[model samples]
Target: MAGEKRDFNTAAATWDQKTHRVRMANNVAQAILGALRPGPDTDVLELGSGTGLVTLALQPHVGSVTAIDSSPGMLAELEKKIAAQGITNVRTRCVDLEKDDLPGPFDLAASSMTFHHIRDTDRLIGRIFGILKPGGKIAIADLDSDEGRFHESNEGVFHFGFDRYLMRKSFEAAGFVSVRNRTAAIVTKPGPDGGVRTFTLFLMTGEKPARETEGQ
Candidate 1:
């Protein structure tokens, strides 16, 4: 996790800016949030909320949201945005996912542009499943593939993104059903030296079965 702590703070500062990179990332995030069929009673939990971008996007749709992230700086920015927007329904918490237990039984759980940062995919999925209520849904939006050499050079293991097929299987193994992966185009401009890149991200979604079938 080379500079993992630094990258998020930088992102939090420029989160509201309309740069191409920011726009692309937020687009994917927004798409993931949009997929959840939120209700008036829906209690949503968002993992890795940066600067309240996704939290603000989802607030109007759900009953309430508890946004969690590991970065204190990011959470500070989220607090500022929450106050400015006068959004009282959204609560921000700084939590270390690798160490802390996710609090829930939430009607739905969602993460955007965060899960790829985690290396232990199975444990992460299992934790999410543990907190979800029966028939609850989990939606994750992240890079489809982690193949860039830069990531390898920077972080020991860049997670290689997520495999759609493997993601579905993991969710199924965790007792979710109606699992599927939805792809959408995410446009990013070139850095100071590199060319522009357009990434196709997948929003993998699954639901916990209301009840197990007979004869299992």
Candidate 2:
């Protein structure tokens, strides 16, 4: 975990310079927005909000956002962007999603491209379930399973990508219902061998069942 944080921190200064990264973030945010259709009263909690690209995109549609990331350097860049844009609805925290407790009971929880970094998806999904309010939704955008070519090196990656079926099963195990998954975007990047590689990004969503009332 320490090594992964260090790598991300080192990449923070130049993270936004990659056009593909920005485009992927935008596409992910769009997918989540379309699925969740957040209202002015929605309270969102974002996991792994590196550099706040999605956070900024989401702020306009929601009442408030609590963005969490493990990398301090990434959060620093996000804070800078938030200040520059005068975005008052978003707040940030540097905390590990795996080891730390999240602040929540949020109407929505979302994440993009960061799940592959975590070692345990099932446990994380359960944690997310606990933090959301009843009937809350979770929207996650991440890469589909690939032949391990996307990341040139797998130093920090826990899952090369994810299988949609397994992901949905995990969501169900975590007690989410009305689950749906679909392709959200496709990204082409230059491979190490000078070939173009296409990676598919998927959007998966599920909703926590609302609490039961005394009378039917």
Candidate 3:
């Protein structure tokens, strides 16, 4: 975990220069915004908000956004962007999700291109569920399963990608209803062996079921 943080921190200066990553983050943010349609009163929690790509895009629409990442350097970069844009609705935090508690009970929880780094999918889903208010929503965008060649290095990657069917089951088990998933984007890149590779990204959304009333 420490090594992964170090690698991300080291890459913070140039992370936004990767066109593919920027495109992916933009697509994911758009999907999330469309799905949630956040208003002035909505509160959002963003996980793995590196360099504020999605975080900045989201702040304008929601009431407040708490952006959390494990890398301090990444958060610093995000903070700079937030300040430059005069985006006061977003706050950045450096946290290790597995070990630290999140400030939440948010109206919506979202993440992009980050779930693959987490090894315990079920536990993370449950944690997200726990942090959300009843009837709250979650929108997560990540690469679908692929051959292990998409990433040149896998130092911090816990899963190459994810399987939608299993991921849906995990969401259901975490007490989310109205679960839906769709292909959000497809990114084609050069493979290590000089071959063309296509990676499919999916956006999965689920809502925490509202509690039933006594006499309804």
TM-score of each: 0.87, 0.95, 0.93
* Position 138, candidate 2: lDDT: 95
User: Could you tell me how far off, in angstroms, the CA of residue 203 lies in candidate 3 after the best superposition?
Assistant: 0.5
Across 49-72, the per-residue lDDT of candidate 3 in tens digits comes to 989888877788889999999999
Stretches of candidate 3 off by over 4 Å are 1-6, 212-216
Judged by TM-score, which candidate is best? 2
Model 3, CA-based lDDT = 0.86
Clash pairs for candidate 1: 146-160
Order by TM-score, highest first: 2, 3, 1
lDDT of 2 by residue, 59-178 (tens): 999999999999999999999988888889999999898899988889999999899988888999999999999999999889999767788777788887999999999999898999
Scanning candidate 3 in windows of ten residues, the lowest lDDT window is 1-10
Q: What ranges in model 1 sit over 4 Å off?
A: 1-7, 149-153, 191-193, 212-216
lDDT of each prediction vs. the true structure? 0.76, 0.90, 0.86
Q: Write the per-residue lDDT of candidate 1 for residues 39-84, one digit (tens) a residue.
A: 7788889898877777777788789999999888889998988888
Clash pairs, candidate 3, are: none
- Angstrom error of the Cα, residue 65, model 2: value is 1.0
Best by lDDT: 2
Candidate 2, which segments miss by more than 4 Å at Cα? 1-6, 212-216
